[model samples]
Target: MSIRHGLLALLDQGPHYGYQLRTEFEERTGATWPLNVGQVYTTLGRLERDGLVAPAGEDGEGHVFYAITDAGRAELRDWFGTPVRRDSPPRDELAIKLAMAVTVPGVDVREVVQAQRRHSMRALQDYTRLKARALAADLSAAGPDPDGPDPDGPDRDLAWLLVLDQLIFQTEAEVRWLDHCETRLARHRPAPAAPQAPATAPQASAPAAPQAPARRRGSGSARR
Candidate 1:
């Protein structure tokens, strides 16, 4: 995520303090990516150094505010116009884990896929519920003109809805990918074990049988 561009976009609206920027960012994006106060100030400092923003004096409560420079407005406009490239996607930890699981010994790839699927499905459900709730609230606030457009123009609610919709779609895609991994794993077979040699038993010896003939010869001689 480009925190720089995000801050610039926020600054384009009006002068805001660090805490205010952070709050608005979370609110506008439906808190999908929460920013700490430190991160907010760090980004603001960078923006000032780059001449994208300037200190807009202190408020009555002694809170320092920052406003977007002309350069910042131009940058924001360009960002809004440009398409986010996907030729080189960021490294996904889950994808890396699944890939490693399938290749490494003693790792159950199916289980990994199933576990991720369950987690992703739950996230999808949550996003769906949030989207529904947001819509319902907006409808209620619309005061019986639920089907009509809002007269408030571009507002925080609209911004949040857009962000929530994106999250829902992204999570749905992840669940589908996990299901694909499981299907592939189902057809996989492990290597067979090696064969072993059979064992043999020892044979017994036969008894001698010629002793009776000698005894009979001796008896015949005595009789003669």
Candidate 2:
């Protein structure tokens, strides 16, 4: 999600206006992470300030264009060469929600898990459908033997498919995680009370012994 690097990479291709870069970025990424015009301009301004990009003159219609500097190209190259590090994972809202649900009093964790599972499942289905359509479109555009090793050239279709596949896989993993949560919650769930027997005769020999309270599970002990 480094918009800076993304804009730099796009500028490496050639000179482009803010709007043009935004359009191409969305097209290549299948609009998975949409960018607003203001965001694009803000990133561009930062790039210009950092000497990563320079003004490439305006078009006939008075649109300011930008071109990547040599430094920007170097940065883009490094970005492409390096693997994305996950040592510090980003905060996920769903994970936080689930954790809070389990800890908060009077909250049904199972219901929260089920709701998330439903949403994730729906998203997975949608991504699957998009992948199917993308494959069909690629095949139709590639003519016969689309899987051949010989790539024609830079293929934006392939770029979009790769991103779409990543999204689908991520959604599938989320659904599986939600299922695991549901199972774990069920295992920890409190047992139901047993039915009482009919009333007996009043004359009891000795007083019944006092029973101890059941130990409640602590919120701190609930992992995820």
Candidate 3:
């Protein structure tokens, strides 16, 4: 998510100082993505320059509060209308590590794969636990919707639950892909060569005793 847009969204809620915006953003995201105070101020500066936000005023502490402009609200609406682009996928560091491991000598690729699978499985478990917590929070915060007879209004835990769900899905996919890779590797392995039977020894031929009989027959006849 763009920090600029995030800050604008927070400003859309209410006027907020830089520090307040940073804290609120982290609270909303459950700190899965922490924002630096410096980044918050920098993004605010850019937003002010773009005319998307403006200085509302300063507090007694000399901290300037910012509020979203009409332009910012329009941008936020447009952002909500458009789906995030997925033309290019972000690089997966684990995938790159495994790719290099298989090509490089002395690297145990299967060991690497197993290690990653273990890590991903642990992450999946963590996300699953967090999801349960989010669901419980949602139930606890449930109230009648103001606009309708629906038993549940918007849950405050929705943002964290969405982030947790994404983590859970991604980790599960990694584990399954690792298992598939192991199966493919095993299938592609070369088969062992079959052992040959011992060779048989050739039998020796009989001596040519018949050849001498021809010469002896001639001599014997002459003698006769």
Candidate 4:
């Protein structure tokens, strides 16, 4: 999602001010990633600097309008013509957590995994509920016969539903992975060992009784 390319594509459609571009971009993207006015201006500035776009004129409110140039059109065409690679960098948070968990001692990894499973399940439930509600509302507003087609229907709703479906699938997959993690952790945990008592040293054998004291003591007592 290059901001420069996106702004150029919008400008290619027609000349527009920064604010107008921002509004249109959000609308077209279903407001999934809200664009700031500053970002729009920044992207426009870059596009102007690159000679992909140029200032058209000022509007009634003194906002400068920008129009795509010949070079911009060529760039847009190249962008559209190019195929995006499906091999994107992976961002697996659970993998990182599991890697670190094994390194930490006394970390009760099972508990950590179970907690994540609970959280993921809750998220899946919430997303499912939201999707159901959205679909119901879309049907209700669809008019008389539920199956009747909408003559003036907008495809934006369908696009939103598709996005929601993707999110739901991702969340469900995460929940299933969490369950597997918990099961594996429980299955692999080692059982606790029983404690042992300390060993006592054997008592030394008693030495032979000392010989009786010499009779000299008795003789000295008699002389005294």
Report clash pairs, candidate 1: none
Worst 10 residues of 1 by lDDT: 211-220
Candidate 2 error regions (>4 Å): 144-154, 191-224
The parts of candidate 1 lying over 4 Å away from their true place are: 144-154, 190-224
Give the clash count for model 1. 0
Rank all candidate structures by their lDDT, best first, as comma-separated numbers: 2, 1, 3, 4
RMSD to the native, candidate 1?
A: 7.5
Worst 10 residues of 4 by lDDT: 151-160
Best by TM-score: 2
Give the alpha carbon lDDT tens digit for every residue of 7-81 in model 3: 887888889999999998898788989989999998999999999999999999999999999999999999878
Q: lDDT tens string, model 2, 1-224?
A: 99899888788879999999999999989888999999999999999999999999997999999999999898899999999889988899999998888889999788788888888888889988998998888887767565664463238889988998899889888888988887888789864568899888888689778999877779458576
CA lDDT scores, all candidates in order:
0.86, 0.87, 0.83, 0.81
- Looking at model 4, the pairs that clash are none
Candidate 2: C-alpha RMSD after superposition: 19.8
How big is the positional error of residue 19 in model 3, measured in Å on the Cα after superposition?
Answer: 1.4
List the pairs of residues colliding in candidate 3.
none
lDDT of 4 by residue, 17-45 (tens): 99999987776565767899999998888
Q: Give the CA lDDT, 0 to 100, for residue 57 in model 3.
A: 96
Candidate achieving higher lDDT, 1 or 2: 2
* Candidate 1: Cα lDDT at 57: 99
Estimate TM-scores for all models.
0.79, 0.80, 0.75, 0.62
